[model samples]
Target: MATSSDSMLAISVFPSLTGAESVSDEELAKQSVINYVEAVQTGNIYESVKWVVDTRFSSTDEQLEQYKESLSSNPFSDVSIKSIVPASNDTFTASVELTRKDDGETNKVSYQVIKRTIVGRY
Candidate 1:
């Protein structure tokens, strides 16, 4: 959920700090976050990469491989977006949850989450 204080700070911070006065679009941020959690739950590496930030976290091979492995092995049934709220004007946080449903022989997994996203594609 986007908090009032967080929104206030975002509206104030970026112009001076990042140069961009406005914060990322709420819908875009929210979608990015949604895609991220959904991809993770579904173990779709390609989908996961689409919204991933190009930063230090993507550089380490060890962590990357581990994440890949984990995603590959997960038996995801579905992913659901729950809620999104702003933490700051430019920054928002989301809540996510995952579940596994058993169908006699196997279990299907799913994800439920809330906030966060990227620059353009909302």
Candidate 2:
């Protein structure tokens, strides 16, 4: 006696019910880098922290403020991922290019992104 809504809920809860495959490690790492860079460029502290695991910041608030200050000081016109290479099983090195908003200068940077599983989620 289940309704269509009930069926939808079940499918949403169990993705395997729809035959959807899990994301690969490489794809996850690449997406992590993209999300982190996008969040930084947009000055979104919360979103930026989601993809980063750093111990340098004393606390979440401190990290947010630091990222905010950095973004305000050096705004970017564009940020793009040039390449992503696997550095280890769960780590990837991404090459990125950024264009400054004020001077239109481009700079290349490398980011080491590590995929972690926390509470049964990637």
Candidate 3:
């Protein structure tokens, strides 16, 4: 089994603005963030990656669609949100904890945030 201190999870963050006002409740905002991440971590690629709202990340609509179709069959798992740090007024970076279903090893997934949504993964 692959075991390491770093999981090398590639969490890509995008630089797109949602333009929505920040939630006043910190805990609520955190939960909202967790919910977004968890949705993507479930690996419903079509539904998950669609949350990424950055043009630079998608490049083209076709690419995003293709990515969704390709990753849908790949193995993925549910994750636990360990920590979330606000990087900007709306953006946050979070540490995602997971146990590989295939190997049973624990690992962490870190990513840049795009506020109020799941950034994306590739």
* lDDT (Cα, tens digit) per residue for candidate 1, span 8-72: 11111222345444554565555566666676676776656555543435454654676687665
lDDT accuracy of residue 4 in candidate 3: 30
Which ten-residue region of model 2 has the weakest summed lDDT?
A: 2-11
TM-scores, one per candidate = 0.50, 0.75, 0.51
Best model per lDDT: 2
Per-residue alpha-carbon lDDT of candidate 2 for residues 1-122, written as tens digits (9 for 90 to 100) = 11111000000112233243485666666767777777777778787777676566778798788778878888888888888788777667777788889888887777776655554335
* Worst window of 10 by summed lDDT in candidate 1: 3-12
* Cα deviation of 94, candidate 1, in Å: 0.9
Model 2: lDDT of residue 88:
74
Model 2: what TM-score? 0.75
In terms of lDDT, model 3 sits at 0.49
Question: Per-residue lDDT for 49 in model 1?
Answer: 56
Off by over 4 Å in 1: 1-24, 53-60, 101-122
Q: State the C-alpha lDDT per candidate.
A: 0.46, 0.64, 0.49
Ranking of candidates on lDDT, top first: 2, 3, 1
TM-score of 1: 0.50
